[model samples]
Target: MSSLCLLALNHSAQADEAPLTLPTGTISAPALDTQDISLQTPTSAGSRLGLSALETPASTESLSGERIRQRGDRSVQDAVSRSTGISRTGTPGDGGTSLSARGFTGQGSVMQLYDGNRLYSGMGTVTFPVDTWSVERLDVLRGPASVLYGEGATGAVVNVIPKKPFTGEIENHLRLGYGSYDSQQQALDSGGSLNDTLSYRLSLNRLRSNGWIDRGDSTSDFISAALRWQATDDLAFTLAHDYGDQQPMNYFGTPLVNGRFHEGLRDKNYNIGNDKQHYNDQWTRLTSEWQLSDSVSASNELYYLKAQRRWQNAENYNWDTAGQQLLRSGNFAIKHQQEQVGDRQTFTFKHSLFGLDSQTLTGVDYNRIRFQLNSNSPFNDALPDGQPLDLQHPDKGRFDSASAYRAQFQSTTKQMSVFAENRTQLSERWSLVTGIRRDYVQVDRDDLVDGSQSDKTLTGNNWKAGLVFALTPDTSFYGQYATSTDGVGGLISLSPSQQQYDLARARQSEIGLKQVFWDQRGEWTLAAYHIVKKKLLTDDPGNPTLKQQVGQQSSRGLEASLELQLPHAWQLQANAAIVKAQYDDFEEQVDNQFVSRSGNRPVDVPRRTANLWLNKAVTDKLRAGAGVRYVDARYADLANRNELPSYTVVDAVLSWKALRNTTFGLQLNNLFDRQYAQSQYNEGQQWILGEPRSFFVTADYTF
Candidate 1:
């Protein structure tokens, strides 16, 4: 064992003054076990012990609905920003947010699940909107989870669990808010049980704002409803539907020397445009539990998800040649549409074999996705004479006249996976968890633009093993190793005639410690991990402007987090991470030097990051909180020459419960009005001014 691992075990032993004890009965019955509740830990359905976050062998984080509401968070982005080893990469044209965990960006690298159903598998667009009103809790599982989820889970998995039906009286909450820059928001949530077996919940939200930038406006609308039916004590059915539409400002790249900060907005004469984005998603699930005998039981879950999205935008640029400045506009438009429909089923059987205790879990999942894209553009050049043209019919000057080209690409992907996991207690203080998974993938692409067709198929096998040792009643230490794979197709080629690339493989190993102190009111965790990805995909350096994927990269890192519930109704939370990601054993076309020898940092990845938050209750009905975030400087490209400056941002909030069932809250984002860029590709003329110190005041009434 490594010295670091020994240190972790030693610490665990020191924290737990009491000896570990095992329960006598089966682990499934929760009423029989006693343990402290820590939001950072995972609860075992069988162990009955409500394990504190410090007791779980793996790295996990939880955001309770109450905590979310207190933060005045409007979206998942707002909630995830506080977690460790997490970041958001804004999408182009559309204001869609994609999550990055550890050192890997979105795609299959990070798994997104809604109610146990895989939501992002083969999904064309990387962004999804989840209604906060319907969320019961958000669980984050860090590190590789491919053994249970099957390929594409190299970094972590985020599970959004929805609220369940209540058996008692009906509940309702309505909120309205108005803020800076003419921003307005309204939301409503209501839920009730219809009968002994049926219950439902509905949520609605709307927001509009005349943004800080010129001609930059945003409008959003969302609606979601859920129904739960418990036909029997062991059988349950759930159905859900969600829809949303958004129109927000879109900005492209600008010259560095542009003295004026346009905030990514185009000048009136630039004739640039923004985008209109739309989304709709729905799902249904059925779960059944059966008790065959005293020591044996069975459970199964079936689920399906359907999602679709569309996006439509025009950009402007200035070209200077030979001391002559020429203004040009690119009237680019793309009709991108995608649909994902899939089903997943899992079954688990619990029993004791011989003198050993174990439960075998088996599952199969299948998913299909249809994606299509149509793109066209027209270019117009301005005259050197600086003549004002007609608004409806602009003149095509000395440069190339209006040129139009369109292409239609369609693709379909199907994936099926089978997995099994078993947990066994080797001794009173030691336990082992082992699992294996196999996945089959098939893809077909059709080029409507050229009548060309192509197909590809791939198969992958992944597994995981971990050992957990309970050093004391309140502390534990664990070490694990896992492997995962990601299919490479979307970024391979724009033309359907090209052959699909081989799957990329990622292997990760981690050791960590979890400990609880102060009667479970405080919890802390530290983990060290190394990940090596083979045939990893990245852009070609020689042709930076082209959209293509090259292979071979790796990343290694360490993460630490602490959550404390202090005296006097105060809470403090902090997370810090350091990562080093780079290309491995690969040579770029620009320079024949191997990437490993060059030692260039991965693009868009920061080496160090940290976040701290403090909250206090001023009175029985009043509360206040403050937070700050820091990100280290990072290289914009693999060469490591262009560096993005490091920055820190601060935020604060206050809330008052004026009445028994009424509350008022105020929030200040970007309290320092810091100007920073989230990613290297961000095109705004200036650093994406972090929301410009906006303020919002809201009133909420609950029944």
Candidate 2:
């Protein structure tokens, strides 16, 4: 349930003084209710037109920070997985923040944004905004999104809405926690009016853990602060800054022995003893909104971001059955430095179109990005066939690579886009919504090692049309068709071979029903969609050594969710999705031959997934909740030679209000001690083990 309203009023007065006159500007508040799961809440992720989830023609959902905390979701990825048709596909290389949705995997298909601004992936990786302490709510749009964003959003969009400042009485919050594996958490937040015309907010959080796996240590620190200034009755401005530093767990995955997982090896860390993985990010933005008139409004945002990341470790491992040992290779040291600057301006108007009530919006966006990469490539400086280590009694060695890292490549990208959206009421029971977007992208790449440079120019057009009909005052039926585009991987870090290919094109058709029943005590939604993507790069049949952009992939699926507030203080929420994802026309190179994989499922895609959560208030001061999640088996390779098994996990939480402004909680995760794999590496040769059973005790205080 989300309780963040789109419109709120604030008194522009100091604590010791009264306002000179009534203010006309509005202030948006964060979602503070843990039990308010209503689709009627307005969200920006689904449509820039300010449509609520129940009114949008696509599948959308919102999860509030308070709700996420009550459910014991510690990370952004874990919190997002609670939504429908979404799953985690994170790895060390991607900063453990990547996701898979709508049968599409990786950052290329599923785009991530912060405060409505995207932080482009450098090398198919995103490492910032992984912490949820600063998040107010998470908005998700689970379908073709290129019509709203730009290319590389063919699957879904996730927007992280940070907490903002509001003019009110002074308030502060503090939280502390201790959990299994020597894990600890500390967080603090404060916000209030600094003056009659200014309000501010600041948040700080730190997390540290000695992970379940041997030698697995991790730490993360984050700071977020903002200031809001009300310049006039109809105008306002806000400036915000955020910074993050992280050192993720060094363990990559456990090598499979003889093509099978061994429970005894699940806790082993296969990486070098002194493995290094770090990420640092900084973001700054200035936003302004002006209510020009009763029928017109304008808004603008300018933002800048800087990021640095580094990784050094043995990333891959394979079991040597003949020698009864493990082979470790793929050793490399890599670094990335990136900077981005962008601005967005939008104008909205309310008027009559063809004698009907209508609202329209027009916007322009421009961005420039610069990135540089440093790495040790080719692996020629390492021992051949990999260095062998004992399987049972291994000694984790230091990172002693003979090759030295050097500047490899640098890239500059300039992107420009123009978009528009319109919604009109055709009749008392019918409405229409339409949108269009055009994007121009230019990329220049320099091969520093070879002292050669090349550039490419690309253009993409996207559009969507949707129809909504009111079956009853409480139920609505909608249908839509949308088109999108996506790059092979990260556009800025395209390799020489990848740069030669064009972007892929995709289309989707969807229909859904939204209804609120049981006298507004229950709500349910159902949606069905089919998507097809073309121009995928695949092996050329005429020439096995070359590639052609003529392959195709498709997926069809059904998604459903239900939330009910029953009697006896019991509340229930459930969601399920079934997807049939496969390569429609494709070929893969295997054993020096082009093999047809037209009918096989894509790697790392689950066919079935479901979640169920139930909460009950035993008394006015005590509450308990339980949840269950299940994921179906998934193939790990193009040929479908290796399959990962299905798994189910359970979590429970209990909290008691000990004081007027304080609460204590006890949370237990993976109650059954289920041993499951979260992700795979090297074509199923290894599996990243999920966290084992753990428990935490926490205290939260507000003043």
Candidate 3:
């Protein structure tokens, strides 16, 4: 979504000079992005009525590919976590980006989309740990998005858009870099026209590194290609495919020293030496667009996805100070193979009912997925080698190779939804938008633990209504109410009890103001929201063995963001968020007794977070940037007894242009080298440490 270029043209007329002629592929004058900090008008993550960000009546933002490359962010995590109101879990180089937003986390709270399509994965993990080099844009929509994306979005939704093809002369971009911990990076992008009506584009990326901790080495590869055919002036078709593979380090976690982190234990890896994780993913899609008329358009998108995942490691590690050794347990291994196919059809047209300008959008979507799981559930023992694990020095390949994987569960899910929306411009400054959707879902599960089969079905109807009023050419105020739900049948396997209950649902009301001031050089947005969720499952009062659907939760918060394209080629950006997430009414079993947790704050959700970044152009060809991020303390358990201290980190970057079309970049991360715990798990016995100071030098060339 981000790139930069500057174009200028001068013309002189003396009888036209015999109709001047230039290069074969050059025409008109150059009009491009003159600066790296300027924001682009987003086409997605909004009302779909072609409204600008100030008129969408929602909180939405986008980061472009050029911005990502300028900052030297290699992975999705590196690019996403720095955005306002966003946090992530998992260690570095783990091949996964688990994100949190609006004080919510996990599969039922957030949704991920690839090029405007859903992946429909709910296995507690995503196999595709994308590389930023292949991305064209990443869009974010905060709060509920089921109105446009179907079910399962409560906190937010992220959309990753890849590069497409264009009809022009061949173009190429290459990058090579070296960094801390013996890391290496290589990336390539090329695209051009094959004929008058055919065009193609390709992207490739690879990263390898010996990480900061012992046995922490990782490798990743990604490749994508697309073909576009301009069949006619009114119709076009696009076909694209992408493949990825990863062998990320299996550094589960470091052992906690006396319930706290110790400097001496920062570089330790307690897991068995043979531990590792790997995965492969593939995706293919086809799209068709037709300009039916000047006022009407239609489109269709179809896609198929395949993935295979594997994990093997001593997932749980504990420190035994008395014995002077580290004890490893919870030996785990599992495999998964999943496939999904889906199709979407949309139509946009103009309509009039009450003598006003009205726009209408209608769409239908359908998807199906088959998931299978295999595991060694009853792990024999952590010490399968029958030898005590030495704390200071240990041998490699101490794994249990005799274990076999057996089918644990199998599931098949199907969903279909239809949606329609209309926007009516009643006056020059006032507009109203309304939308509604209906979704039907079905789940079929086979329990391998017992010889049994179960089927579940659920239906949901959601709606949205909003109004926008413009006070000036660049200022607007808006308010909206929206509804969403969690899949009733669940995205993965469903139990017999889940088939008898309804799906949990939520609704939110929000108001906000958006303005672009300082002669269109600065933009600001602010919003406040209150949300309530109902029909969550909890233990029944009369029957201890049964469950009831009477649980509820609520979250109230405020968000603010500001960006300035200041004078002298200097830019500044900042954002902050504060929230209170509490259980409205719930009860759980504790020590053989059911207790109330009606006012407890949810675990893993922080109350405050903020970010600030500044960049400047020192001269015609030299630039520098710096940023800082602060994350407040977080409770690791529901009881609020285990707390992880807060921490702040800093980063900086410098770039110099040495040639006409080449640049050298040096990036420094965690400049202060402060140590902090990203998170704690396994009853506070394991800790994931944040990375230390690191730097990289990159050479980029364009042709």
Candidate 4:
């Protein structure tokens, strides 16, 4: 179903272009899809200078909307999974968009953002399966980026760029699609200027489906809008808003039998009938820019985000061999309500620093977040004869009783940061890049269970330096060392004792080569890195009441990627990575005694990963594409007791230009119907089944 949205992306795509007029009043951004999809000649991923990807010293990649739509991606995960080294680490629903990268995973390491604003779930919460229809481009920076974004990005940062109002002739797009699992999709995009001083953009999408699992149904809608005002030649203002209401796939996961999957029960769901799970979010932002002078510029942004989530279901399950039945033990009803408000001010200038050509960016940011959670389990009876429900025939209504929580908890986080980065040209062929950031974080939590409270305040600093040398006009070599930090208890809450725990710290060093080959249409990057993470929290062996922060983790790895624009309108892209990650010095209290877990690999982290994709225009009217994704085996738990075997999936797409503005297409996912778990936890005892082979057809029109 992914590629169907691209049915009309032929040579005559000018009618679909959506150019955005910038707040700077004099600048405009052409539809990114019209540019080279691979090189991304202009981007803000690694630098605010608008440097080409080839010049950005970091390992960064950007994919245009056209490229993502061509692959028929529906969610943020869909687009990220195609990138090399990035492995899906959790379900898309629940904002469970955890990703494994570099040598770490989760919210404390890998970060995700909407636009340039960090979704700071601080407590491992991520925004839900954000529909791709609202994304204009995705930029990924695969290493420490704390200098740009404050804290917690030792692994990587994924920035989702949304569609903004652009100055252009009126253009609109409509797409309709249907797929396996009884899925339906409809989307609309409209953007243009009302006049020379005012322009607007709006995107809307509606989706529904009966999921792959029995009785698993889902419905979702997303809407985004932006209004831009070019009040004068020196200043401008813009406002944006986003809303999402979702009922994601109801299937939690299937339980394993005898420590292994049972193929016959693959389509079964353990949730109760009439169960409920839903998420809703609303966001608003205001931004303004002023060109104070030719050598100076300033900008400011303010935003607010609110979200609510609910879950009611029979969430945990396992097979009872002796009883010859399916054992379900947990019924949970939980709710989360969170809100965030923030502001940022930035100043940039171009000048001669110490007689060297230099470009500088300095910014200050402040953010405040309020979060709360409530839950209740009404049934103390583990098995009202439902303990071992008959596997052959589960009572459709046996576990239908609703849940009620006895209490509610509250938490709040406040943070402020000041950061500065300068790029100085040391010479015609050499450049120096340096930046630093200092952050002050405060957190307060109320434990309703005991009517107790805990609060903590911490501060940390991060910095990075890099040296770049241009060996030739089309080739370059670079080396960099960067540092960052992780919260003592992730970003949300901290253990009572750890309230004083120093934030975990991390540092990484890397060397890489960036080159343009096969003329200007191709590029290749090779990089190697060593990273160390320390101050991991663990219980004190000598004193059970105390906690220690001596644990450490390390990883060394190599990554390579090649992108080529081949002859005859063909394009090829391939990337792969191999890493050796280990818990260098980790210990835990087992059976009231300390036990070593020094050599185990981090859970859900694969040692190797790779992806390959190819697209060809067989004729001016037809286009075809194929891709393959591979992930090596990984541990599901910290003890390494359970292993999730490796898997490879194949996907294909074919599209036809049926008319001047209309296109039709078909997409096949998991072409071989591969049976594999996307990821696993709970000691590999529970399996999150991967999507099965599915098909979809789509039609698109422009007006």
RMSD of each: 7.4, 6.1, 8.3, 8.2
Q: Which stretches of candidate 2 lie over 4 Å from their true place?
A: 1-37
lDDT by residue for model 4 (546-651), tens: 8789999999899999988899999899999999999998887778888888999998889999999999999999999999999999998778888888999999
Residue-level lDDT of model 3, residues 1-703, one tens digit each, is 0000000011122223332221122111111221332223744766665567776778787777777777767777667767767776644222356667786765567777778887776455675646888887777888888888887787888777787786778788899999999999898988888888878889998989998988889888999999888887777888999999988766766676556667776777766677758888899999887767655778899999988888877676666667656666666678777888999999876544244566677899998998887888776663653334555554454556345558888889998999887777769998877778889989898978786998877788888888889888788898989998875434665667777888789998989988889888898889899888888777776788887899898898998999998989998988998889888888887776888878887766778888888999999899999988888887776667777778898989999998989999999988999888776667556677777889999999989
- Candidate 1: C-alpha lDDT: 0.62
Report how far off residue 418 is in candidate 4 (Å): 0.4
Show where candidate 1 strays beyond 4 Å.
1-56, 93-95, 121-124, 252-255, 258-271, 280-306, 315-331, 377-407, 489-498, 537-551, 591-598, 682-689
Each candidate's lDDT (Cα)? Answer: 0.62, 0.86, 0.76, 0.80
> What is the lDDT, from 0 to 100, of the residue 527 in candidate 4?
89
Model 1 — TM-score against the truth? 0.83
Q: What lDDT, from 0 to 1, does candidate 4 have?
A: 0.80
Q: What is the C-alpha RMSD, rounded to one decimal, of candidate 4?
A: 8.2
Best prediction by TM-score: 2
Q: Give the lDDT ranking, best first.
A: 2, 4, 3, 1
Model 1 lDDT tens row, 1-703: 1221232245344343432233323222111111223643464321112344543456777776566656656667567756787765545443345566777766557666665666553333544564465566677777777766666677777776666555545788899999988989898887777877777777788988887655567777777677767665545565666666665544443323333334333222223433444555556565554544443345555555555454443344443334334344444455555556666555553333333354556667777766666655333323333333332233433222244436567878787888766665667888666677788877788877679888777788987777788787677788888788865534212244234456678888888887777887887888888888777544455555432345566788889998899999999989998888877655444454324323566655778889898999999999999988887876655567666677788988999999999999999888988767665443322233345688999999998
Which pairs in model 3 have colliding backbones?
Answer: 1-64, 1-65, 1-136, 1-137, 2-64, 2-65, 2-66
Question: Which candidate, 2 or 3, would have the higher TM-score against the true structure?
Answer: 2
